[model samples]
Target: MTKPDLAKRPDDVSSMFDRVSRGYDLTNDVLSLGVTPYWRMRARRAIDPHPGQQVLDVACGTGTVTRILADHGSTVTGLDFSHGMIEEAIKRHGDHPNITFQQGDATQLPFDDNTFDVTTVSFGIRNVQEPKRALAEMLRVTKPGGKILVCEFSHPTNGLVNFGYDTYMNVLMPGIVKLVSSDPEAYDYLFNTIQAWPEQATFASWLREVGYEQVAHRNLTYGIVALHRGTKPAA
Candidate 1:
């Protein structure tokens, strides 16, 4: 499920998200059965960002994880290609000086080599047309020994669970999205991408191949969600 080399490029996906930005978070909460926030908290746990540390959250749609990580004591910069999402993030969290939202690309992050103490991308990598390139950028910005945390909807292993989740995402969620956002088709695409995401083993191997060492993953909620973690070695 590598997405068939999507004709929609990275910028196209970004634009699609921007168009649906207003209702995006709400849609996630409803569609995922209010578990998306719990997933974010778990992703932060995987990264284990510390006080006074600098962390970057890529594809930070409305900065849920960004603000959460900031509150945990790290100075966080939330980057997204969608201006609308960034605007919403600022509108919601601008009162916190530790959290800053900016417009940036995931595959081509606007940061120097080895700059961040940690980096995290929650439910974002699947939207990138070039996921490997974004992963490389994430590794490039992470300081030696720093962790890269990724939370994604990995394809379920259990047949029964997968069937139920797919029913929710593919069958039930579309109707919900239609009422929530004008671009219901975008949410449909999102569901399709989730189904098409690479399995956990392949993704962990990909992370190691991209130069992230100590790769590991943990399943959540009966394989409906997963958190993958890796670290760059100090030279």
Candidate 2:
């Protein structure tokens, strides 16, 4: 299926993900050189979820992050705008006792204010139509003093690393995707979005603008990806 240029069309992004849902995980693993698991582990540790806490994993593609949170004893709600992705997530982890999957938008979350102890989005925030609105919604739905974490691709600080990463994303990634991905164009869209996303420092500033405190980011893999965390200010 020919997908709209997702960077321009916010509504089309979900459908693009839906079409790629079946092979998403496998293609991602291949393209990331099997390092995504390491990234997710670092992101999970950043959250440090506790038993009995209510957590929301926004844009929780295929439940990878959701499962991590649930495994740590948090009552996790995995929310994604893509129904196909949600279906895949349920099929993979439905039997997990603490995880529930929901189809919902990031910019306009379907939850009450202050409903969760932690709100997280992994590699999904950049796809949102209005990231600031999404961040505000994350803050609104999280309890005061609760944490918000965003894990997303970022620019590499090292010149050589940046050049190599750019070549991989622009040149080699598409070839690998064509071999393994159901929708190869989706990977092209992925590369475009990653290129367009803000760097670590700018994203941390966005977190603070949305009323989060202690906004900070930890770069992983030489700044190829960043894990950002902030706390909803206690009133």
Candidate 3:
């Protein structure tokens, strides 16, 4: 099956997520075998969240990455376009004074320029209708000299592993998602989207094209996931 073009108009993008909001996290964990949390841990370490820094966690479904950033002493504002997802994140993480959950579109953020010390997104960029535009917004909100960090899925370069990984994601993962979620095809689209996502180097170059400096990327778990980072230029 061909991958769905996730980069589309706002209305189409919004509707896809509204349907998946109920089972996004559960399907993610099942597909990743509960290792998505560890992937986020590596992303948190790479970003080096610090005290007094304000961070934005874009597409912060269920506040997974938001809570991690908060635990590292950074003030985190988690945003998602899906109202149900944002409400879930708020219910889960909003009690903490350091973490705020809100509904916002990635292509059009609500904050002013350089409003945050760091901006991060986990497993969300691929779903954005305009990834380049969304990345630009991330750069816009991040102060000069701060970080724009990302953690997302990527296919393996190793041929043998790629074959096995594809089998698992396309076959077994969907079965599991079906068991856990009524929205079974939503996870299927996730598999499709990740497979269609650009390579790690391609994404890093996209960040550079969006005006991010010091861009770097590291593949984790044999290339099933990748963590990328870019820093805003200091004046």
User: What's the lDDT for all of these models?
Assistant: 0.85, 0.90, 0.84
lDDT (Cα, tens digit) per residue for candidate 1, span 1-235: 1222345576667777777788788878887778887888778777676787999999999888998898888999999998888888888897897887889989899999999988989888988878999999999999999989899888777899888887877678878888777777787687678767898999999899999998999998877888998999886
Q: Looking at candidate 1, what is the lDDT of residue 68? A: 88
> Which scores better on TM-score, 1 or 2?
2
Q: Which candidate number would show the highest TM-score if scored against the true structure?
A: 2
Worst ten in a row by lDDT for model 3 = 1-10
RMSD of 3: 2.5
Candidate 2 positional error at 201, Å: 1.4
- The candidates, ranked best first by lDDT, are 2, 1, 3
For model 3, how does the per-residue alpha-carbon lDDT over 11-123 read when each residue is reduced to its tens digit? 66556667777677777777688898789889989878888989999988778889988998999999988877887777777899899888889999999998998899998
Lowest summed-lDDT stretch of 10 residues in model 2? 1-10
Q: Candidate 2: TM-score?
A: 0.96
The best candidate in terms of lDDT: 2
What tens digits encode model 2's per-residue C-alpha lDDT throughout 1-235? 3475644465688888888898888888999999999999999999887798999999998998999899999999999999899999999998899999999998899999999999999999988888999999999999999999899999899999999998888788888888998777787788888888988988988898989999988889999999999999896
Checking candidate 1 for backbone clashes, the offending pairs are none
Error of 1 at 109 (Å): 1.2
Name the candidate, 1 or 2, with the larger lDDT value. Answer: 2
Candidate 3 stretches with Cα past 4 Å from truth are: 1-7
